[model samples]
Target: MLINLSGVDKDNYTLSILKSLEKHNSGSLKITVVMGKTAPHINSIRQFAKTAPFECQVLVNANNMAELMAQSDWAIGAAGSTSWERCCLGLPTLLLVIANNQRTIAEQLQQVGAAISLHVQEIDTPKFTECVAFFRQPENLAQMSEKVVRLCDALGAKRVAQHIEDLTKNEDFANIRRATLDDCRQVFEWRNHADIRQFMFNTDELIWENHAAWFAKQLGNPDFIMLIYQVNGVAQGYVSFTRQSENIWEWGFYLAPTCSRGQGSRMGRLALAWAFAELGAAKIIGQVLPHNIASLKLHEKLGFFRLPEKNDVAQFELSLDKCYIKKQFHSRFKIE
Candidate 1:
């Protein structure tokens, strides 16, 4: 689902893309544009299309988004926030990376072979046509679609619940226990790092005093549960869960700034497994911005299913009773 956070400039790129689509005008290709939150840009697009084909349609709201994307072959979407929704649905895309904030995500998606990122300067009529034509090649489109299908097969919610199950199953992997108040000091360091903050919600660098206040407030919230991860008895990272309600949890985590040899996913899975099995919850949800490719992949790996989307952050869920563990338990031991 494309969340039009482009604000007033929403239709500029979509219109350009549609103009290119007209040039190709393949009867087989069906396209739909979903406009959200009163969709101011719809009128602008209407003005440009003199005659609308039966295949091209526009929709509003989250409910229609999944249906449209499911029915269509591919999506040409904004790069920043809407990207996750596309990934969550396993929809391959040709991205228009419209903002500076989106560069990291665009590069990551390209690295993983999930998307092609186009600059605004490179988004003219010819380039757009070429992208559409290139993907229309059945083999190329299938390969790209396969990547998305694998990455987003389950909507992302279920993966998280399964991860929690993993953690609970291997309780010994809870390497760090009895995290003290001082533990936030270490997490704060990573939170304030340049590379870490770049992908984060904040733009400016973090000040210790201000950062500490935020950390304390987050830690203090009864809804917020923080757990530190360690190896060889040293603090390496942390995992956090927000008890969203009796039935839901919002989760996030970060490893130490320098510790990037793929250990984060393992730790995440362990922590997630713990949450679902031990925390006594019906479902676990994760809200991720579109740009976090690693996190997106991790979510996919853990079986979190994405909801039909509406906003910048894609929503994924995992139901405990339906998770893989339950299925396995029922099969292996016939508990069910």
Candidate 2:
């Protein structure tokens, strides 16, 4: 866990967090705290670090917030710009609203189940400790992280770039990255969603045991690429490519149920571009349910041609040479 107190010189919130940690120490949770860049309360954090039994770090002007935050499973951060950064990484936070201006951001995130907002006036050991303890549950922890991604996608920057080639700057989407074991729980949530599962070739709610086993194999499989899409550093959707042959890949994707409509089209475009540009695929194919009209249209919009049904599945194919990516839909990578 990484606890960031932002730029506040002397915050009572840090003390509250430390006290909470002291009580939870026996549980074996390691913690690292960043006491503001120009913290005047450094003495307290440093002193606590020395006497604490659990692994604890007290950093000032802590190194790359993104990298540090990404490495952490949970954060107790001052509610501010870093809230968005947390959202991007899908790192659930117990946000301390230190300033009056921060309530709206904190509240909005809380409303979306992305975070828990606590007024600095109420900052104390007991309440903070309770929240941390609740998160210790595997189901609660996984759900909170999953909710964070729904509200802010870490891939927003790239998704926005896919629409505007000449734009110089934007924070609309987050960078897309390969999936790992840590993401299995979240992927399971997306996959098990009734809406998402219904359109699959096999429409069954996967049990955790089976899903975990399948997901583990996919992560290390060279023939499969599972990418998590983030908007503003929070995960919003999933895209994957499975190798069918030497020059062809089968692709599929789905947006979080809370995601907006037009974005699905954008994701398809981005995934297709990645298949051609990154993987150097000669062609890409999709298996669509005949009743799944939305996917059928999406494939056509992205230049996929209809083919005869294969084993009761509506088949679509896009040959690299004939693909016609939408004008507003651009690839994240440059087209040389």
lDDT of 1 by residue, 1-336 (tens): 222334345446767666666666655665566666566677766665446442566655557566666766677777787677777777778887788988888888878999887876676657766877787887887788778766655536788888878866754333534245788678778877876776676657778888678777776677777887776567777777888778688877777887747776666656666676567668888777788787778877777887876578777888887676434322232110
Give the Cα error of residue 255 in candidate 2, in Å: 1.2
Which run of 10 residues does model 2 get worst, by summed lDDT?
Answer: 327-336
Candidate 2: where is the Cα deviation over 4 Å?
A: 1-171, 324-336
- lDDT tens string, model 2, 1-336? 888877664645686677766776534777878766567778877887888877888778766788888888888887898898888888988888888899999999999888888877665556766787776677876898999977777777888787665564553664456777988998899888998998887888889999999999988898999987776667788989999999899998888878876877767777777667678888999998888999999998888889999888899999887865523334452322
Each model's C-alpha lDDT? Answer: 0.68, 0.79
- Runs of candidate 1 with Cα error greater than 4 angstroms are 1-11, 24-28, 50-54, 153-336
Q: Which ten residues in a row have the lowest lDDT in candidate 1?
A: 327-336
TM-scores, all models, native as reference = 0.43, 0.47
Residue 303 accuracy (lDDT) in model 2: 82
